[model samples]
Target chain A: MANDKVTLAHGAGGKVSQELMEQVILPAYGNPVLNTLHDGALVEMKGEVAFTTDSYVVQPLFFAGGNIGKLAVCGTVNDLSMTGAIPRYLSVGMIIEEGFPIKDLQTIVSTMKKMADEAGVVIATGDTKVVEKGKADGIFINTAGIGDKIPGTHISPENVKPGMKVILSGYIGDHAAAIMAGRHNINLPASVQTDCAPLNKMTKAMLEAVPDIAVMRDPTRGGVAAVLNEIAEASKCGILIDEDEIPIHAEVQGVCDMLGFDPLYLANEGKCVAFVPAESADKVLKAMRTSPYGQEARVIGEVTAEAPGTVGLRTGIGGIRVVDMPLGNIVPRIC
Target chain B: MANDKVTLAHGAGGKVSQELMEQVILPAYGNPVLNTLHDGALVEMKGEVAFTTDSYVVQPLFFAGGNIGKLAVCGTVNDLSMTGAIPRYLSVGMIIEEGFPIKDLQTIVSTMKKMADEAGVVIATGDTKVVEKGKADGIFINTAGIGDKIPGTHISPENVKPGMKVILSGYIGDHAAAIMAGRHNINLPASVQTDCAPLNKMTKAMLEAVPDIAVMRDPTRGGVAAVLNEIAEASKCGILIDEDEIPIHAEVQGVCDMLGFDPLYLANEGKCVAFVPAESADKVLKAMRTSPYGQEARVIGEVTAEAPGTVGLRTGIGGIRVVDMPLGNIVPRIC
Candidate 1:
């Protein structure tokens, strides 16, 4: 506890490890189930549950809106929500580099607790391992979550069909731009912050309003382009989008243009693209707009019967161009 | 796919990411639930369930008997089993250092699948991320598991009371000895390999044969000494063990003695310590001995009313010595 930086002993599963758990971790995320300190947490669960896991290795650790801790929690929460489940429990596995600041760890953990509280999930169980200095970056977090599946809802790429409306919850490339700016020391407008927020509430509301929604995916790493291409291939349907309708913050657009980065392939941490039946598009969009995270939700595209298994973009000049799945790393560790 | 080494593109959430999933991961872990390829996997659950997570950063990814991948899966499964649960599902999250061999990745993943199959659990969901070279160790694996709690069993340290017998599943410290030997380039007998096998079946048998088992804990990170100390504190009872009765392989004992290590403080990947009523201890031990993983099961100690919240070791020299909780790193990354 006296040391400001983590040491190998802190992860040696000895007295120091217990001190870290009791002092640093338990205070932030302890609940009755987790406080038991059993090898695993015991909780009552029934029916169907959705399970998901994600590892956060985002660089800079902190960016405009959130840190790796917040992303770790929200990313798993959104993944469960996208599966039509109410996010419930999460397990955190942290790999910390020796000599890393304990203060930074505390900040990250507190941020994680805040996000977990907002997403209505408990940090049920966790483990931490510290690697020798230089063997790892600052810190990498892996979060696995369990959520109760919403009844009467079937959300999957298999449900995606021709004629379904494609909804973009908000602007793209903000997360990537924020991270790039931080890494390159490029000054940006105050408005060009990372769009990192939990989308569980918004997605839950949309699902409640329309349980028959085909599919919902948070375009995090490969951006919307990858999501669209996967859906198209899985559903055996073509996806066509209007370039004018795909929302991009003006500053974010400028950053992308300046860097020769295609916004379509850039990551967005807090956005989701939902495929809804034509009849339910308006209702689902309205439901999404009711939440702050989705206030800018728009119908950016539609599933098409032609050109099955491909995505196309209708440009401003009234010409259509193929939108390819991102081929390689545009930006590594963007989240 | 053409690259022999994993690149940043594999974790870019783009086409290469998909290829990694379909070509490498899916082929190894494909199941009905995981094949859905949604944001999460939907699994059926009923009643009380146990959830746990552990991150494996073991050095020398491959050690005697198993590699980190096998350790990743078996560790979680054993944790769930130690909670008197029937392990069912696991979520794997991997962080690979850039330039890590794809062949090694494939070998590790296939070993994971093999171990999961042996444990009768499914790899339900997973995530992968790649960091720049030198930013991470060769690879780190995080596994989170879910299991159904065995009905009518109250496995908790609080249930551990005075007069309860302490049962150790098998010989201690083989795992640590093997790892230490590998790291220090010390030769070891072939029989002194890591005892990193899934203990679900063995524990399940014990629990079924004796439903009133008080507590169960796998002596993983901090080894049996830490486990006993924690149990003593949590149960508010003193634990007294006979050092002569504690089982340790001859070669492992020699290695520990030569290296100034105590087998009591050495880690075990596939061992558990259980607390049970005196009347049930024999039956539980009998059940444990029926499994290959627990062939050396022994009643090495007992709970005592005197010196509550402490552990005492009765040495062969006719003197009782206090067994302190491990205070520092004995072996780093020994998982």
Candidate 2:
């Protein structure tokens, strides 16, 4: 406990590692399965399941609203949520740099425990490895989640069709903007904090209300433009979005304007884009609006039969522009 | 294909990332679940499931007999196998350094595919991220595996009692020795190769033959000594092993002697130790010996009622040495 920093011994799978697990990790994320301390956890599972993996390497480990640990948990949970699965268990893998602050690691793990609890999942099993000081950044976390797939629910881009309406669950670009602001020390408005929260509950409600929702995608990484473009390519259709209808906070918008960045391509940790049949759009949107994370839900676009693999943005000034899939890297480690 | 080296753009979740997936990754690890290209994969899983995770940050990415990619797959698969589960699916998460060679990435992915196929598991889902050159080592892989837990399997340390016999799957120290030799350019014999192979099939056979195996653990990091000490502590029983009976390859022993390392404390990627009721020991050992991976399997020790929570080694000489859990970092990234 006196060791303020993580040493190579902490990850050597020896007494030091055992102490870390028993004193730090176990106490933070203790559960019956994990407490067993076997290399893996055996749990009774049934029905179809969704499986996903994601690694969080966001710079400035601590962002405005969440750290990499919280992002790691939410990202994987949201990935499973998108597949219409009731998120269940998560396995965490940490690659820590030698001499990294053990306190920071503990803080990150605490955040993971908090987020996992909020998402209604258990940290079933985990592995930790420490590399030499420069061999890795402070710490990178990989979380893989498993969830029981809901029967009668099929979520895929292939199910998207012409005349389907695209709904944005909430604001976009908040996560990327928050991370950027923290890295550059920009004094953005307090309201511009990262919108990093678990979207599974909101998503579950929407799915249950409208099982025919064609495609459900969380606009992380490449954001709305990339997601719409992927949908168009997969469904072999065109997507047209009214730029004005896309919800963007004034503060986040200001930050994007100042940085010459397109909010459409910015990453978001908590938002989702659902392509639902036109008839069910209102019902799904109403259900989304009922959730705290989806209070700003709105219909932003619709799928088209023309231009089979292109996304078009209809500007407020009556101009239409083709939005290609994001090219090159605008920002790295935004997630 | 023009870009022979990976760039930060490749992990930006944009057009370049898509090309990397479609042109390189997809072709190598394509499967029905993964081909859907959803954020996560949906699979039909039923019954008891075992889940585990491990991150491979082995230095000298490529060494004798295996590479980091192969280690990543085998490590997670073996972890699941140790729980008497038939490894079914694996999720891969890669953190790559910018400017890494695309050829090397392809090689690693291909190696993963080959290993997964050999292990009878599908690479169901994956994520890729690129960090700045100095922010990470060339590549670190985290693989999480899911397996169907055998119905009657109850492998645990607490199941160990006074009359259980410990069986080691094969020779130890080859994996750690291979990595060490590669790092220090030691002129070791060619046979000093990593014992990094998936042991799921062999384990499955053994479990089917002896349903009452007391415990199963892969002697990975910290090796046999660490594993034995842990078992002693967990079961609150004494473990007495015969040093002369322990399996050690001549070349591995020579290297360990030259390096002032204990083979008992060296890592092995593909080996496991199982505690079987004395009556079932022959049946389990026969089943293990029939598999290619377990040809060298041998009964090395037994549980004891005295000296609870301690591991005692009966040497070739008349003295008995108490083996404490490994305390310091021997080799940093032996895994």
Candidate 3:
């Protein structure tokens, strides 16, 4: 327990592991359900619920604006929120490499606790594993979340139809650019920071106001381009967007251009693209703008019957170009 | 799509990841909930439920009796079952090293699917990430399970009382011995196999007959000694175990003897120790012995009021020895 670095014995599920939980982890995430110290946590749930999982392997555990722990919590919470569910419980699984600093682990876990508290969710259960130093990266976290589905709400791509509006919440490429900057030691502008914040409150309010939204997705790894393409394919419709309507911070745009990257295909941790019926677009946008995380909400596109399952961009120069799903790893480990 | 081995692109949330899911994972785990391909799965539930998670970093991905995939599924399932819950939905999060064989991945997924089907649970949702080669071990699986708790069942250490009988489902040390055999290349008799099996059905049946079972704990990492010590500490009572009654496979005993390891402190993947009122012990034993996994069920000890917060073993030679929670990693990444 006195060791400053993690040791394999700390994950052997023995006295050392128990001590670590009691001394470090439990203090950060202790609750009635977790305090039982049973193999599993017993909880109560009613009606329908949402379940989701994500593994955060973002390199540079400490990144601009947030760390892997923060992303792990927000990513899964956002996934549940995208389904019109009230985020409730989450289980964390950590695989730490031997010799990793215990202090760093504490910092990461504290970040997760803070993020979970802000999202109105509890760390209900967890597991920890330690591998030899070289067998794993510094640390990887896998979080699975359960949320209560809102009544009278059904969010699915099947509901998308022609004349639906596509709204992008806030700027794009910030998360990707920020991670890239840290990983490659790029001197990015100070404003280029990870937009890694939980969007449950914002999305919950939007869904409450407009329960008929067709689809909701966080633009994470493959970013906005991939989400739109997926929505188009799932809804069996075409999407046409105006390039000028897309919001990209100048710093992020500069970084993307420097790396020959398209901001549309860069990841954003705290943003969502929602497909809403044309009639409800204005109301949903207004609701989104009221939230700090969605202040830059913009109606960037609309669904179309022509060219079903494809996405087209109307360039500011009056030219049309097809936007395809991201193909390869333009930016790896971007969360 | 033509790639024979996994690459970083497969974890990039781009075209490759989608192809891998569609061509490899989806077909195996495609259920109504997962087929939706939304960020999270929507499931219906009412009343109390059990939630648990475990990360499997077992070395020697494939062992004599099972592989990491089997352990991953059964470990979480058994954790939920220990709470007297009927295992239902599971979420799998896999982190794979780049260049890992696609065929191996398929084999693992297939094993998971088969185990899930046998447990009568659905692979509800999952996430996949591929780290750069060497950044991770071959692969590590994190599974979080949700189960519906049985009504009228109150299983906890606090319920343990004097005169309560302690029953163990089967032999100990098989899982740890099997992993150690593979890791150290120790030749072992063919009878030495990992006792990796799901105990949900058997447990559900047993609980039906004995609704007031005091505690149920799977003797996994740190083994029976650790579990008993924890229960004693939690309930603020003393536990006395008849060392002679503890079951150990002959081959496993040989391996442990040679390695100077105690079977009582070695892990068992599919075995559990239950505390039940003396009146229900016989009925529970009969119920457990009826199941395939619990054929070796035996009454190994009883709860006592003396020496609170400690565990004592009555040796066969008429001496008593204190058994403590494991201190260090006798075996690392065993399960």
Candidate 4:
């Protein structure tokens, strides 16, 4: 507390470490379960549960709409949500570099608390470690989460059928565009902020409306193109998407065009691609559109038995082009 | 597979990333739960669960007895064990720097699987992120675990009372001394390696023998001294330990003496400090001794009603001294 910058002692598991937990961390995310200060937290869990983990290493720390802290929480939360689980608890493990500003650390921790609260999950248990300066970046956070599975839903690629409809939750490329703008000092319109929000509520509503929805995935690092390719390969089905139906913000489109980037391959933090049965597509779309994060939800594609294990895009020019799985380093550290 | 060292593409969540998973990670830790390759793993869970998280940033990556990977798994398992739980599932999150050797990564992942198997836990889910060369050290691992609570046992500081016996599992300070020797290029005896082993089996046996064990703690990072101080403060009781009764490997003691470090304050990745009722002390000690990791288990102290919130050490020469909670950076990145 005496130093503005974190020192190695703060993670030595001694007096200083205890002080950091009591003064800095506990005040922000403290709850009955975490306040026990035991080796771990004991919580009640019943039935089947979804488990997931993600490490956030985005550069610049802060972005247009959210910081790395927000991503840390939402990423795992969305992963569980994609499994048709109601996310419940999260464990935060932070690796901080010595000499890092404590103020920034506070901001990050507070943001994590805010996002966890918004997602209706508890910050149940955590650990902190500090590496010597330069040995690590400012800070890297890993969040692992658990959620209860929705009873009647089975979310898996094997459930994908030839007549299934593929839906996009909202616009794409906003998150990656925002990160690129910050890195390159490019000015962008206000509407082009990162679309990094907790999609649990939206996905839960959709599942409640149509429990038989086959598969759901958040197109994150490799974007929609990569997600579709994986699903196609795993389910041994073909996917054909209409380029015109895909939504992209105008400023994001302009930036992607100028930078020679593909909107379909750019990362998105808060969007989901769901494969639903043809008969329930309209109902699921209506459910998604009711949430603020998924207001632009639309049917963008369909699954087919032809050319199984491949994805094709029907461009506006009336020619079909294969959308291969993204390869090489299109954009590093987008998450 | 063509690259000998990791590149940014290996973490871009695309073709290369999938290749890394299929070729490297899956071969080491693959199981039905993890093979689903969904956003998260859906696993069965029932009753109460213990959840914990830890990030391992140990330097040198490889030490005498274990590497960071082994520690990553063992550390979380031990935390769950200390909470009186049967660790069942673990999630691994890795942050690797570009240019790190693929061979080294394979070694680490394999080691994690080995440890997880030994501890009777599954690597249920995981995530990987890569940073630029200078932005991170070789690699850091964060492991979060969930374990089912052992029936009929309540391990908490609140269970501590006057006249309770404190049982310690095995010799202390080997882990820290081995790390120090590696860092300073000191030649340690072959017998003095890092004592970083999973303690779940030993703890499970002890709980089965004596379910009323008051408190359980692994003396890591801040060592036995820090654990005792915390227990004393939390339970509002005083602890008194005899210096001569504490077990310390001769070579580890020599290393500590030469380096001006106190064995009691040095870390032990495998050892545990347990507070037990006087009547159950012998049964718990016998249970610990049956396990190879806890063969040198012994009673080192007793809880007292006098001088609450303090720990005292009785010297061999007939004097007592207050053992203050460790302050400042005693040893950094020892894990």
Candidate 5:
């Protein structure tokens, strides 16, 4: 269990990490699904399955509003939900450095169990390994999942059309700014909290409301700008996003300005960008705003035919700016 | 995507690592199985499936006999083989450090695909992440897999009873000595190449010859000593082994003596410790000795109900010594 500190034997995959599992991780969430001791979990369920896996190697494992455990659960669950799958089962594999603190591990794992139960995804199977101190940071998590992929509901980037409107799910860049402040201990006028929560419910609601939604993407690592260019390229179309209509929280905007960062490039975990038909844009926004996660949703962009394979931004200076692909990493390990 | 020298952007899980996948890892072995992005690779057959996952994080990712890629494939396939599952599909998730060299990345990935083909397991899905330079040694791989669990075959530790003979499939400690020498530049009088190779064929042959093999374990980490003790505790039986009967290469023994290390505690990448009923021990040994991985198989010990939960070693001096469980780590990260 890589809690706070790390030792070398943890990565050895020997008795040290095995004991940590028997004593720490296993006992806290003991159930029949976990005791089978199989490699990847074997789950018997009653619906079409959607499986996804994500690896989390976040720096400063314990962050401001959430840790890697919470991120692991939410990240994979959201992937399932984006496809309108009812998130069902999850398998967690943790690699920790030896000599980590026991208390810190407890806090992170307890948080994970709570968050998973809230998301209606059961923790079915798990694996624990400890690496030598220098071999790892603090702790890293990789979660693979099995969910019921919705029947006959397929939404791909190729589905985007010329007059589709893009919806910004919530305030942008809050997760990125929160992490930066926590790591550097930066003082700010207002508290900055990470927008790290399970987005499955919000995603399912959106899918139910608008079954024809096209190109659903979580603006995570490279943020909205990176994904916008990717969606445009994939659909062979153009995206024209409004500058002022895009929503940003005050604290996040202040941090971006102070740090020479752009809200467009900063990461956001709990939010998503969805492209839908122009006629239903208002109705979709109304449905999104009713959900807890999409309270700040807005129609911020539209698909265009004039400039295919590119994304253009309407700037505050009354000029158009091409929102090209992110040149390099904007924020490291923000997820 | 563990390039020779890692860069910080790899850990970002964005563009840099994505390029690493497209250029280095994926192109080296692009196939239809890999194009399907699944969590654990799905192996379709006429019946049930077997699931497996293993993480590889070896220091100095490239080595003399083989690199971490070979180890990852061979190790996980061997695990599936031990469970009597015809090893089939594998998923590799690589966590690479920033500043790693591209040349080394190409070498490791090419070897990985080649070895996967030879072992008869397809690389179905893969993921790549880059960490900052200090976060990891070079690269760490997490592999998850699924295989078709064969019907009408039951193998477990509970089958071990009094009078079962222990069969060691090959020499001990060669891999351990080779790694220590190569990593630390120990100029001992030994060209001790590691005994690392795929063992699925050999295991398959042996299982066919002796269908009721009691227990089978790959003595990779913590070597023969750990497996011996684990079987003793699990089956509630004692193991009486003649130390002289155990096979060890001359070079490995020489290195073990100079370093004040017990050969029993050292790791071995290509070896197996099996328990079979006395009636089938000879048949199993003959079956194993016919294969590349188990050509030097030998009978080393016998199970006894007296002095349960303990392993007793018969010394060359005609004295008996009790072997205790290891307290400190011996050769951490030997995987």
Candidate 6:
């Protein structure tokens, strides 16, 4: 098993690499779409479509709760979900450093396959290249997904209304904390893991519960603040988020406090903020709560017309502060 | 126009980028596949298929002979052709750095669109992302391709026979020489450019003229020596290349001579090698000579029963030398 750890042969596309994919990665996440095992997946859906692409250069390929592989798939699927489409296919391209262990590659690929299968998406096509050892940090993955647009669903930031309520799908900062914890080898694990998961199913349930959701965004890179700021800028409306209303897991919050980090600025993968008419915000959140990924759904903010392009947060202490877009990298390269 | 020299904005998928693609790329080489402008092209054909993917990370996005965009398309298409397939569709992904000028991106994308069109392949799908200044050097392109296997064209190294002759599609090292020439800024009123172009049309012609061609390959990355050595190893047969019969343009030969780079290991974009029955080799060469990309086609080698897995070269001095597979990177990071 010691020999099963990272090996240069894994990047060689030879037997060692094959074992890693077939044994570790695929078994955990294999499905019909992911099983095709083709270069790029082929998807057959009948409808006008929306397409989205993303690249994951997350450092520390294997993080706390999950690895870069799962992040790549979740990020891409979430992008399509935001557009009200059912993502069906994906293209994966990996740039690996030559000396990278075959075992690590196998793990990453198997994870990708498994995640794609779970999300009902396929890894239709893939390309792999080995760069000289020093050219790349380890392995970087780039993926593009295509989804069939829902027949009549349209959700855009421009649709946010003054009376709309902002819905947080689940706990925040779990993924970021988990990754940081793993990277730094933080001791004493007490069930603190990354919340990396596919949001497509959650989006589907929310839309089915109430199809009139105004805006849906996964707070990944810049977290809740970046997404909220963008929605405000686009809708020309102000946002008021209650600090206590946002859901943060106890472990994640504890880690954030210990590290002097703001949980609001940390990344969340299996989470999203949905703006809905005040009348049906409860209905949407109720439906989200029933989904596995959104059990912690809560109302974090409300849309307002008082101050345009600004997101104001009511402090837990009855004070207020502005939530701004992230300036520099946080948890640098945390997918 | 001086303004048209090069700018990073040209590849942004925005207005100026569109302009560059429309003007330089489309105008130079426009066709049905290139016009669709999808992220990954939709290709339909009836037959078993072979697909391949490649990424171009050539430094100095624009080199002496061609740019990253051209290399991306050519590399994928060439792989498709080598497998005896009709390359019909291609997907492109570009990772461009922020602050790159609008003009440069345009030049690159336009070149890509045009070259794909000329290759008779469509640019089906594309994705673009901007990395911060230091993340990426300038621009990196990734291309994936699909093609229908040509009927009756079962070419493979496994089919090479004792009496088969090898044909060179054109002169060697022109492309590498062109890049070197451009990089050094050598003053030559009559400077030679890279032989960068689509080889599909020429490949199609060869298949039509002689469907029984045993093997076909493009000496692009590791060059002709690499390809030949691979075929020899795969087929478990010896190969004898006639140095005098190999084609080399005067300018290309001059550059290679000065640089001490052998033509056999030099990269070629618009060229290929075909191993066929001695009887069909001449006819195949004639067919190759008719296509724009194959005007310099000629027979340069033959399969032999002696010394399996070894490739020998007959020198101009009447001596024989074993041609081993390239040990190190040849044309490092070309495509």
Best by lDDT: 4
- Fnat for the candidates in order: 0.90, 0.90, 0.87, 0.91, 0.20, 0.03
- For every candidate structure, what is the RMSD over all alpha carbons to the true structure, in angstroms? 0.8, 0.9, 0.9, 0.8, 3.9, 7.2
Please give the lDDT score for candidate 5: 0.75
Q: Each prediction's TM-score against the native?
A: 0.99, 0.99, 0.99, 0.99, 0.86, 0.69
When sorted by lDDT, best at the front, the candidate numbers are: 4, 1, 3, 2, 5, 6
True-vs-predicted CA distance for residue A114, candidate 6, Å: 2.8
Q: Score the docking of each candidate (DockQ).
A: 0.90, 0.89, 0.88, 0.90, 0.28, 0.12
Candidate 3 regions exceeding 4 Å error are none
Better of 1 and 3 by DockQ: 1
Off by over 4 Å in 2: none
Per-prediction backbone clash count:
0, 0, 0, 0, 29, 36
Candidate 1 lDDT by residue in tens digits, A175-291: 999999988888998899889899999999999999999999999888999999999999999999999998888899888888899999999889999999999999998999999
In terms of lDDT, the poorest run of 10 residues in model 3 chain B is: B324-333
- CA lDDT for candidate 4: 0.94
lDDT of 6 at B189: 31
Model 5's CAPRI class?
Answer: acceptable
Q: After superposition, how far is residue B205 of candidate 5 from its true place, in Å?
A: 4.6
In Å, residue B311's CA in model 4 sits off its true spot by: 0.5
Cα-lDDT of candidate 2 = 0.92
lDDT accuracy of residue A29 in candidate 2: 97
* Candidate 3 lDDT by residue in tens digits, B97-130: 9999999999999999989998999999999999
True contacts kept of 1: 0.90
Candidate 3 has an lDDT of 0.92
Residue by residue across A4-61, what tens digits does model 4's lDDT show?
9999999999999999999899999999999998999998988898999999999878
lDDT of each: 0.93, 0.92, 0.92, 0.94, 0.75, 0.72
> Residue A270, candidate 5: how far off, in angstroms?
1.9
Model 2 error, position B226 (Å): 1.0
